[model samples]
Target: MKLTIERAALLKSLAHVQSVVERRTTIPILSNVKLEGRSGRLSLNATDMDLDIAETVPADISQPGATTAPAHTFYDIVRKLPEGSQVEIEFKPDDGQMTLRSGRSKFSLSCLPVEDFPVLSGGEFPFSFTLTSSELKALIDRTRFAISTEETRYYLNGIYLHAATGSDGAMLRAVATDGHRLARAEVTMPEGASGMPGIIIPRKTVAEVRKLIDETDGEITVSLSETKLKFAFADAELTSKLIDGTFPDYERVIPTDNDKVLDVDCKSFAQAVDRVSAISTEKSRAIKLSIERGTATLSASSPESGSAVEEIEATYDSTPLEIGFNSRYLLDILSQVEGETARFAMADAASPTVVREVADSSAIYVLMPMRV
Candidate 1:
């Protein structure tokens, strides 16, 4: 394949596609990106068996052909090339080596047969819908942090997305939990999403799609089946296989009838927890919250590191309550609140605490209390 493309455009597409290629792979072609040049455009594809990313960019085609080259190496070479320089890529059919020429620099890299690269079959999609870029970003950013890293409970490793009925009727919800904490976020459901199956999108795919959505304001076309999910946005597309397992019933864990309500500034509360937790033990990053009539005091003590105490003004009419929570969990939930104030609803020190953005109750977070 021979093509001339601008460095900036080439690098942008390369950056997206190459990130899907694994740094180490048992299969030779899996570590390389398939480059296809035909007509007036160049397509780059890379996959790690479970997930695949394909990107197409306009180019001046001199010879129509295709080949597979080392993903990271080719990306690095083009990234380090002089800015704004036109890149000429030529593949010698006889020797199977791809030559890259940009200004004064030239390099010959080994290539693999394009036929060896794996392409995920666009399986039969039973359901499809479109979502705004910003909405998808909000769902991922709010819940991804709660996905479990534990390999044993593989089902909890990705955000659980499906259709649900809320106070506003049917809505698209994304829920994630790691046993200790849970995040549930949703947006107005599109017409066709009512019968969509609940799918657990792997953590890696969520992160990749997040990056793609942030780069553009275009709508994302999502297609899903029983086993796989696909996201198409702008010039790029990502397809990933769903985790084959049943997600736990998350609703049962969310505490209801929590009578105590504490409203405090989200930023100040997070900072206070962070400051107090500094002296907490490494094993248990616990910060105790003692709430009374109109104030909340945060304290942390370690056998070896002494103790810390900080108070933040709050509005609480319920009886005094003392609860301990992991500092990291508190910070994670606080970061998701868009409003200046956070509302914490608690039943007792032993029960899970419900957290919501003071200005919006549509999104809720649940945190399990810990022993101080």
Candidate 2:
């Protein structure tokens, strides 16, 4: 295959596809990207067995053929080339080498047979819907941080995307939890998702799709079956395998009867927790939150290190209550709020805390308390 393409355009597509390729792979072709050149376009594809991404870009094709080349090396060569320079890629089937020429620089990458690349294919998808890029990005950003990194409880390793009843009737909800903390966000349900199956998207797939989504006003077409999911956005398309396990019942964990309310500035509360936690030497990163009448205090103490105390003004009218929580977990839920004030409903020091943005009712977070 031979093609001459603009450096900027090619790099844009390469950047997305190459990221799916893992540096070390038992299969030789898994580390390479497949390039197919036709009459007027070139397609770049990369996959790591479970997930696959393909992006097409405009190119001037001199010879029509296909080959696989090292993904990272090719991407690096294009990225480091002189800005605005046109790149020419030529593949010799006889010698099995791909040559890249740009201005005064040249690079040769070893090529693998395109037939060796594995492409993930899904059966007919009965459910398909479209969502604005911004709306989809919001669901991911708010919940991705709470996904579990624990390998044993693999079911909690990704966000649970499904249709559910929201505060205002039916809506699409994204929920994620790692036992200690949970995040839930809802969006207006789009059409054609009524028959969609609840699916657990793997953490890696969520990350790759998030990277491909840009700030444009384009709509992404999402299609999914029982075992696979596809996202077709702009010039790129992604396919991934669904995580195969039953997600735990999350509704039972959310508190609905907690009435002790406290309203405080989200930024101020997060900053205070960060400062107090700096002196906490425990692996749990625990910090105490004491609220009474109209003020709240945060304190952390470590026998080896020193102690810290900070008082912040809050709007609370309940009896004095002291609760201990992991500083990292508290800050994580606070960072998702965009509004100035955060509302916290506590039921004592033993129960989970309910947190939400005062002005936004579409998202809610739950944090489990820890022993100080």
Candidate 3:
């Protein structure tokens, strides 16, 4: 393959595809990025068996061919090149090397046969829909923080995406949980999205897709089948194998009869928690929130570290209650609250506390209390 592409363009595409390549892999081909130059475009593809990414950038193609090269090495070479430099790539099949030239620098990288690269089959995607970048970002940003990192419960390691009925009408929802905390976010269901089976999008795929969202404001086409999911961006595509497991009935964990309501300024509450948690034990990271008529005090103590207490103004009408929580988890949920006020509905110190923005009903968070 012989093609000339601008350094900026090539680097941008490489940045997207190279991340999908696993740094350590048993298969040599899996560590390389497949480069195809044809029809005035250079397509870059990289995969780690379970997740795959393909990106295309404009190029002047003199010879239409394909080859695989070390993904990280190629990316680093192009990245260090001067801006506005023209990158010329040539593959010599006989030598099994890909030559890259830019400015006064030249490098030859060993190439693997293109035939050895694995191709993730594009299965039939029966349900496809479009979501504006902003909408997609909200869904991911709100819930992904709670995605489980535990390997045993594979089902909880991804965001559960499905269509559900809400108070307003049909909605497309994303829910994630790690047993200790849960996050749920939804948007109005887009066209052709209803009746689709719920799918668990793996944590890695969710993160990669989120990064792509930062690059464009255009709509993203999301298409899925039973076993796979694909997110099509303006200039790139991400296909991933969905986690094969059944998500628990999350609604059962969401409390419905929480009588105590505490409304606190999101910023103040977060700041107080951060300050008091400085004294929390490293293992538990526990902090207690004592809520009374119109104020809340956050406190943390440990055998080694001294105790800390910070009072923040709050609006609570219920009887005084003290709840213990993981300071890190509480702050994570608080950071997702977009509104100025964060409303916490609690039954008692022992039950799950539901947190949500006072003005936004589309996103909700649930945190399990810990014994202080």
Candidate 4:
């Protein structure tokens, strides 16, 4: 196969697909990217068994053929080439080798047969829908921080996406939790999403799809089956195997009868937690929130380090309440709040606290209290 492509365009596509290729692979062909040229375009595909990414770029097709080359090596070579330079790639049919030429630089790379590369089958996806880039980004950004890293509860390692009925009727919701904290966000459900089955999208796939969506403003087409899901954008398509497990029912954990309500500036609350947690111990990075009539004080103390206290004005009408929570969890939820103020609904020091954006009710966060 022989093709000529602009360096910038090739690099951009390679940068997107190569990330799916792991640094180390048990199978040699899995480490290489499949390059195919035909019909005036060149496509690059990389996969790590579970996740696969395919990206295409405009190119002059000199010969219609395909080959598999080292993903990282080819990316590195093209990345270092002079900007705006045209890249010529030629692969011999009989000999498994690829020659990359740019200006005066020429390198021959060993390649594997294109047939050896594994192709993730585009399984039967019965459910499909189109979502705006902005909406998809919001769902991911709000809930991804709470994904669990512990391998014991493998079901909680990804974001749970399902359809549910809210005050506004049917909605497409995404929820993630790590036992201590939970984040739930929703967007208006499209016509076809009303009875969609719940699916747990792996953490890595969530991150990759998020990156792909940020690169373009075009709408993303999502197709989901029982075992696999696919996301198709302008010039790229990502396929990932769904986690084979059930996500816990998250509704039971959300606090419903919390009577105490405290409204504080999201930025100020986050800053107070940041400053006070500086003196908190490594094992328990807890910050205590003491709310009274109209003020809130954040305090943190460690046996080895001194204590820190910061007071912020807030609108609180309930009786005085003191609660402790992980400083990092608080910061994560606060960062997702779009409005200036954050509403914290509390029942007691022992129960989970519900947090919501004061101006928007579509997103909610539940944080479990930690002992101080």
> What's the C-alpha lDDT at position 64 in model 2?
94
Candidate 1, residue 238: lDDT: 96
lDDT of each: 0.94, 0.92, 0.95, 0.93
Q: Give the clash count for model 1.
A: 0
Give all TM-scores, in the order shown. Answer: 0.98, 0.97, 0.99, 0.98
lDDT of model number 3: 0.95
Q: What RMSD does each model have against the real structure? A: 0.9, 1.2, 0.8, 0.9
Model 4, residue 75: C-alpha shift (Å): 1.1
Which digits, one per residue and each the tens of the lDDT, describe model 1 over residues 226-293? 99999998888899999999999999999889999999999988888889999999988998999999
lDDT of 3 at 311: 91
lDDT tens per residue, model 2, 271-321: 999999998876979999999988999999999888999999999998899
User: Candidate 2 at 277: error in angstroms?
Assistant: 1.4
Cα error of candidate 3 at position 288, Å: 0.8
Ranking of candidates on lDDT, top first:
3, 1, 4, 2
Better of 2 and 3 by lDDT: 3
The Cα error of candidate 2 at residue 162, in Å, is 0.9
Q: Which residue ranges in model 4 land beyond 4 Å of their true spot? A: none
